[model samples]
Target: MAEFSVTLLIDASTSMTVTADTPEDAAELAMDEAGNPSLCHYCSGKMDVGDVYAARVYDGDKEVLDTDWTAQQLAAAEKQVEKLEKRVAELEQAEQDAVKVPRGLLECYLNGGGDWVEAGHKLRALLGGGE
Candidate 1:
């Protein structure tokens, strides 16, 4: 979801780096690049040992070191989204209820010089008032 720039310390000696969407992606890229046996097979001499260590991870300007919280974060985000959706639905229902006056009553009220008391009686009657 976000781009990360990772600086890896290879075998505690050389610097191997990669930019990816996640820290896991960066680690996989570093491992694939450093641990490939084909390069050693092609060369006559023995290859140096390399172990990938993620030295630093950056998401834009902020530094991110903890890469194990993805599942927790996703669950939290899902809950927030669900809450927002329910709030939106409640707001929509409130809006609909606010404008639920009968169309004929509204037309008559608008045409009859805005009679507030008569419109109020009509609205109360439409809403099943005893009076």
Candidate 2:
């Protein structure tokens, strides 16, 4: 059996310290402590024993537990990022295509031709709005 220091956090402003042989024992102690009616330090309502959540455990200055996301979670996050990036790239391509003027319209605009009114309308439609 190893000595464990547990920090029991009931809410944002309430916490207590207790020592136990193991983290599990510490958690149990915390639950028991929270069940006590007098130990309700922050809330006016009755403290539910289920609300006694263990925030962290440590052995001296070193933390002995892992509370981070698992490898599967990290992999899923990476896949989501990839999917979002691909969607962004597709949207960027669509925006580029939308802004692209037809070669004939470009030539007509540059040449100052008689079909300027029709070319301007085509340009406005391609750009999604009129200037």
Candidate 3:
């Protein structure tokens, strides 16, 4: 990431009346009046801004920056996030439909005092193999 400075150019219209003997003095007074102003009855204090907007950006090396760089990064990031979210949904669905057949058969034979031969027959039937 780099640093940026943004400057906005606007237009402000104003008028001032000054009492001076010479035109040069009046010009000087008008220039000075630009910085210091009072709200007048006829003047609206709001600044007028046009539709056009522009920004000049430069890095530390005085190099010009590519404006589309951030947009490209955002598009790539969105694609990656979509792929990961799809894979996560697939894993969650598989977990919900999974059956622990081997563990269940082992527990039935060893813990329930059921015979292994009978358990094998049942396992075959449960797996859709012919008994």
Model 2 stretches astray by more than 4 angstroms: 1-69, 102-107, 112-114, 120-131
Candidate 2, which ten residues in sequence have the lowest lDDT sum? 46-55
Higher-TM-score candidate among 1 and 3?
A: 1
Q: Model 2 compared with the native: what TM-score?
A: 0.34
Residue 81 CA error for candidate 3 (Å)?
1.4
Which order, best to worst by lDDT?
2, 1, 3
* Per-structure clash totals for the candidates: 0, 0, 0
Ranking by TM-score: 1, 3, 2
Candidate with the greatest TM-score versus the true structure: 1
Task: Write the residue-wise lDDT of candidate 3 on 43-82 in tens digits.
Answer: 4354333431222123334523222456557778999999
TM-score against truth, every candidate:
0.43, 0.34, 0.37
The global Cα lDDT (0 to 1) of model 3 is 0.59
lDDT per residue, candidate 1, 72-115, as tens digits? 57768999999999999999998888778666468648865799
Worst 10 residues of 1 by lDDT: 36-45
